[model samples]
Target: MSLPFNVQRAQDRMGIEDPMADDPGLFHLSRTERLMAFGACFVIGLALSIIGSALVFTGHLAVFAVCYSLGNVVSLLGMCFLVGFKKHLKMAMAPVRLTAFIVYIAFLALTFVSAFAFDIAALCIVFAICQYCALAWYSASYIPYGRKIIKSTCGTFAKSI
Candidate 1:
């Protein structure tokens, strides 16, 4: 099946090739199937995250941390369905994304440590916020000029302040 015009255009602009264009060896899936898998994983991850957030009211910090972290990880893994796992890892470890990736992973781990080991709710919250910011930064790195735009906007806001 043909891709939508916008999606095809964006893929062209980004120099992205269809994962199924070449034989992927094992676990092959058509574009539509891959999209379905990605969508399913993303929705499941979002549900887990929402459930974790709701658990916060019950004061189950450890469970919240575990669920939230797992949710984020699962969501991230969903990208592998669109791009192969090796390609995803290569892009993640690229120089542009390295810092954001490190910070994101660090915060993810720190959130768990603070919640389960240290039993520090405040610290866990702080780490969770950092993890989210890092994840956003990492995601924005994928778009053309996205990081530059964000930096410039933040700089302008800082100057105004």
Candidate 2:
């Protein structure tokens, strides 16, 4: 009979045993942890954007612009549901704001493109600048809210919905 190719392949040339064979399980993120992870993703987005801007008159763009844009949209929705709509005011909201901050940094590339293409009129540019100004202003606004949310999450109080 033919040997099981799959089983036979397991015997590597090095003869190393399956290192993961004894692992009980893998790590899984909690709901809150997932949010944090998603929020942290924005930071990665910003870094990619900077690197992209340096290459090919804007390289690494696929990861930064498109991916970051997607992240922004997802973060916005999460904020709406977990913070804004809940209006529970908690420190947890801070992560979402952090996401926004990351999104804004990523937007610089888009702004550059728009500037070159003149996508928006002077008013558009002005408005875009103003938008970031307001976003920055409000990023700090959520600190107190975030504190409350954290308290709620930690079961200190029913702060966030």
Q: Highest TM-score: give the candidate number.
A: 1
Any idea what lDDT model 1 has? 0.84
Best by lDDT: 1
TM for candidate 1 is 0.82
In the range 92-113, model 2's lDDT, one tens digit per residue, is: 3466555555456555455446
Which stretches of candidate 1 lie above 4 Å from their native place? 1-26, 152-161
TM-score quality measure for candidate 2: 0.31
List model 1 lDDT by residue over 1-161, tens digit each. 56789988998999987654544423677778778888998998888888988887789999999888888888888887777677778889999899899999999999999998999888888898888778878988877798889899999999999
For model 1, what is the alpha-carbon lDDT of residue 5?
98
Steric clash pairs (candidate 2): 52-59, 88-160, 90-145, 90-146, 90-147, 90-148, 90-149, 91-146, 91-147, 91-149
TM-scores for all candidates: the values are 0.82, 0.31
